[model samples]
Target: MARVQHAKDVAAERLLSIPGVHTVGIGYKRRGGEVTADLAVIVFVDTKLPRADVPPDRMVPLEIRFFMDSSDREESVPTDVVEQARPVEYTHIPAGTLAGRARPVAGGRSIARAASGGGTLGGWVWDGLNDEVVLLTNNHVLGGAAGTDVFQPWGSTAATDHIADVVRTGTLDATIAAPVNAADVLEEIEGVGPAVFEITTATVGMPVEKSGAKTDHTTGWVEYVGLTGHYGSTNDFQVAPDPGMPNGRFAYYGDSGSLIVERTNPSGGSWKRVVGLLWGGNPELGNAKAHQVQDVFADLNLDTLCAGAFEEFLDNLFAPNFPEEPLKVTPIQLPEPVTMPLTTGPRVSLSGALLALQQAAGRPFARSRPLHRGMARDVEARLRLSRMGSDLVTAIHENRVGLARLVLDRQTRRALASAAAPFVEGVWTADELLGRQVTEEDLARFHRVARIAEDHRPELQPLLERVNRILGELPGRSFDDVLR
Candidate 1:
């Protein structure tokens, strides 16, 4: 038994590495119309299962069979090996144009057909990994890509229906749709009911129930855990074969994406928790399987959203200005608040604007002081750029287009300081005038705000363009040159 179980585990890992093999598991190999205790690794490739009319001994496909020995080595079983191969299967919700919900939509009901507009909505599930509500269904159901519009009650009834946006898409044969309105979602399933609050794992022989678009409600037993299918592998459950149904199958074609939940208590009304996302099954053989929900979420990286939020919370917890170590036990004492004076806008008069421009340039006006004979040439250039900026602002306000253009060009060149700008220590540009730490950030911020203002106020567009042009050029000079 231990060898068989290890063989099962090793075979599953090997098949998973091979492309096109969907799921893997360990089950009794059927021989001469009977299941043998001799365990074999069951693998589902993109092949079809044998129909009921085919005898069990003849049901095994000749193309594939793999086995593991006690030494944990994999060898292809001989073609004469009669072990039955369960072909690839998928949820079978049928294609239809039906509409009009008899009530608010719930899981296991018909939603939109596949993005191909064909399959059924498997179910609705809460995304536990992320703190948001999502309508759970198959990737095939939601158009197999992000941005598919999911319609409630089928896309057939276009008027007076609900819509949700597909947000996540993946190879697990699963997609999650987030609705526009939160209230439209229903927590309770449609039939064979379980109100899903949390997801649980699957165990072999676990009694599970599923409500789907086609079957409505049905009960099944977990036959194999960790089985792979064409798109990906997880677990496979066998729907109880019922003689009354077509081919004795429990679910029909439209049941893809159905939620499989564990029945907590067999004899009483106990809560059923979600165990898997049903995608496909064999009608003739009564074999079916689903991707485990937790596995699906993890594969899709859905939990990363929660991790980002947790990081932000941690940042706030350790913020500075708190009491020092030994005194840390005491409540934090915030520093006294600083008050800043508010100004409406730049000074309106030409003289006042010129003074404002000088202050903004962070340098003395040319006429304010006598320059030393050996002073760097860029100092005089800086003063010239500030004067030109003040002149351009006036020209723009007065609609002197030609003068504004010429002054704007000169000012922009000066801001770049390619020739007239000096490098300041540890600064990209003008480090001596503006501290190294805040130079880049403050200039970038100013550029962004001016660009936005140009978009909203056409009258100020010319002035704003010049402002942004200068800010963009501010990073060209280095700190050493400015100090020299």
Candidate 2:
């Protein structure tokens, strides 16, 4: 392999200078329309002309020579010429209908710099050092000085459509953009579902798939790895379209930055493991070129393809809403029976009255405490608060008091209802004992409840205070801290 690579390197520049030649790489040679096991310097050309029709100087050589320094010798390696009209970078003009605007943006959708043409979003990746999620795409799509605005659906001019900003670019034709809101991005590919966070190296003959802005989803097979194309781009792999694909093309223009993934089946389930980032291709020959995914990650210093914080957010979102069993309230036991005199004259036990009240309230009271606790920890609930708080904060921070008040009105009713359920239950229980004067045993039971409540106070207080402020019942400075 090294000998063949060295030979290709020696002959590539001279061969590429030939009139019809397009690219030079190493791959299995083909004879009589069938690929053979023999390795050769594969030359892609615009036309496969007969010797009589081509000039001697423009003719591709059958073999090339490379010097071996160790043995003080030179050796001849064979070459194979295949027809490819032209190689093209997959960007600029929109050619297909697979792209559209999406919210909570994901990969394989249309995206572009605010001032540039559109391309495919490769995927989402985590920049652990910055504690954020960023969008991955081709350099030509998102590359620029830091803070260059990016948008979805290619040419959207609305401020609300502005999604990310270019933060990093790589020599591998890769670029990453930090999203304006990390929570608005998902580590998923359109039509292909969630991608495996890890990447695998591309190998010859490996079957692969990619979802792109223009092509949507397509299958291909690795033709060659470690291939160098025009302009001296290294560490690239070539993909040949599946024979069943339309026009034998795996990718089209505007499909740049599409993530090439290998689909693997283990235990009867399929997973998409990333292999490369699509950049350029020869659509006529169905040969697409991409930088190895491993190289892309190394160049960008990325941790993983999926955001950890978003994973946590998802976990909180899909968790069960209610515990399997109802919350059992243990009655507050007193050391001795405390009799309370009723206005009717017959004496009743305070603990007995409390038990009777709880029974009267039935499942509604029994279910309330757990429901409140569950909602406090749920992501959907948190998102509600975050959304409301963000609206109010943005309004106030931007000096829009009228908007803030309107947001306050809408959020306050919901917040008060959510915040008051557990408190209402507590007050109702306390009201039952109010008719009888407070006693030593009653005071002891109250202290026990206080001690129990204190353990969970730290966790519950932030949520309560955030709700209180939204309802205009508590004075506070920032809703952001409480939401966090």
Question: The CA-based lDDT of model 1 is what?
Answer: 0.51
Q: List RMSD in Å for every model shown.
A: 25.2, 22.4
lDDT of 1 at 97: 25
Most TM-score-accurate candidate: 2
Clashes of each: 33, 0
lDDT of 2 by residue, 70-106 (tens): 7768798899888876667888576566677788777
Model 2 residue runs over 4 Å out of place are 67-69, 72-75, 92-97, 128-131, 265-270, 306-484
lDDT string, candidate 1, 1-484, tens digits: 3454454554556555644345566555666657555555665554444556554532434323345454455554311232234544453434422223635566776777434443455444444333244677777666556556666665443634545667677767788876545446555667645344446677665777777666666776766555645474544444443345444555657677777877664424323567777777665565556777677756654421222222222221222212223324666566987679987976354434654553343212111111112122233334345555445534443432222222223233233233212222222222244333336655665565454444434555666676565555566443222222
- Cα deviation of 294 in candidate 1 (Å)? 2.9
| Model 1: lDDT of residue 120 | 52
